[model samples]
Target: MNKISIGQSELMASQISLGIMRMNALSVEEAKTVIETAISEGIDHFDHADIYGKGASETIFGQAFKKLGISRDSVILQTKTGIVPGIMYDFSKEHIIQSVEESLTRLQTDYVDTLLLHRPDALIEPEEVAEAFDELEKSGKVRTFGVSNHNPLQIELLKKFVNQPLIINQLQLSLTHTPMIDAGLNVNRTEAGSVLHEGQLIDYSRINDMTIQPWSPFQSGNGKKGLFFDHPDYLELNKVVNEMAKEKGVAREAIAIAWLLRHPAKMQPIVGTMNPDRIKAITKTTEISLSREEWYKLYLSGGKMLP
Candidate 1:
């Protein structure tokens, strides 16, 4: 897998991340195989969330890591917090501190390599977040901090008070769900795609030296419809991706991910596949990059247009 330094941090991580959000559905042995497979394929960074399966995903991954017998220092562990299911978003100092403590215990580790705020809290107080981060950093509970699904201004608000570097911003991005890219490419147009939903997030992330981690790389939309692989609505995209895969001599999944890797923004794509074979196949993305024309072809095939 390709490696990149996250933000200004010295922590170099694999460009391809293994997201264990669905690991709670697998048996311990099965989860171990999946994790070991990812490591073998050069994926050292794993993404988790405190709310995934009500924290069962982290518990399962912890058990698998122990059974795999790999040294803790060999892999990078990142997890998210602040989402309390259907209740509310909590960035309070009390919730942040307690959450990390719980995640630490569940993962059987003293500290997480990276900790992220799972979602933005409408009722956030940056000073309270700063206090929580100070405590976590002083105690060595979290090495780095970041956010997810946050707009540019939201990050600016946090940066005002938080002393630590906010290194990552994980967002839902795929060929078919690219409001950020659309807004940038179709500026000043009256089309729906030109409406700036994310406020130049792609540009902001690049200019700020923050890594944008794209989750659900294979999904077409909000994921309510499912994978776009053979979806009838995405015939052109599927056809183009399949052709590219054939030409590249890799799986179709690899082509989809390569589109992300080809971007100059230096994105890290988090894959959620539990199948060992699928994991190995997608790893091919780091080996190849899409040409400028090819990249645009795939983008247009996704039904996005340029004015």
Candidate 2:
């Protein structure tokens, strides 16, 4: 796997990270095998969220880690917090500290390599968040901080008060759901693609040296249903991906991920597949790089039009 430095942090994260959101569906033994398979394929970064499987996912992963007898420092564990399920989003100092404490207990680790606010809280107070971060950092509970599903101004709101660097911003991005890329390509045009829905997020991330972590890389973002593969609306995209897979001698998923890696932003895609075989197949993305012409072809195949 290729390693990219996360923003200005010292953590050199893997280009592709295994998301444990669906790990709750697997038994302890199965989860262990999946993790081992990813590690064997050079995937060292694991992504998690506090609300995933109601926290059972992290618990199962912790059990798997203990069963494997691996050292704590051998891998990077990143988790998100602040979502209270059906209740509300909480960024209060008390909730932030309590959430990480519970996550640490469930993960069988003393500290997380990184902690993120799962989503924005409309009623959030930035100073309260800053205080919570300060306490966590000083106590060695969380090594770094970040946010997920936050727009550029939302990040700036937190950065105004939080002392630690907000290094990563996780967003939903895929070939079909690509307003970030589309807005840039269609600048000054009257087309719908020219309207900025994400507020120059890609450019802001690149300019600020923050890493953009693409979640649900295979899923459509604009209220579309299910994975992009085999979707009726994405027949053209499937055709192009299949053709590239045939030409590259790799799985279709590898071509999909390679398209994200082709961008100069150096995005880290969080793949949530639990199948070990599929994980291994997708790991081959590091071996292939998409050329500019091929990248545009795949983009257009996804139903995007250039001005």
**Candidate with the greatest lDDT versus the true structure:** 2
Q: What C-alpha RMSD separates each model from the true structure? A: 0.9, 0.8
Instruction: Mark the regions of model 2 whose C-alpha exceeds 4 Å error after superposition.
Output: none
Model 1, global lDDT: 0.93
Name the TM-score of candidate 1.
Answer: 0.98
lDDT of each: 0.93, 0.94
Candidate 2 lDDT trough over 10 residues, lowest sum? 216-225
Model 1: per-residue lDDT, tens digit, 94-177?
A: 999999999998899999999999999999999999999999999999999999999999999999999999999999999888
Model 2, residue pairs in steric clash: none
TM-score of each: 0.98, 0.99
lDDT of 1 at 227: 95
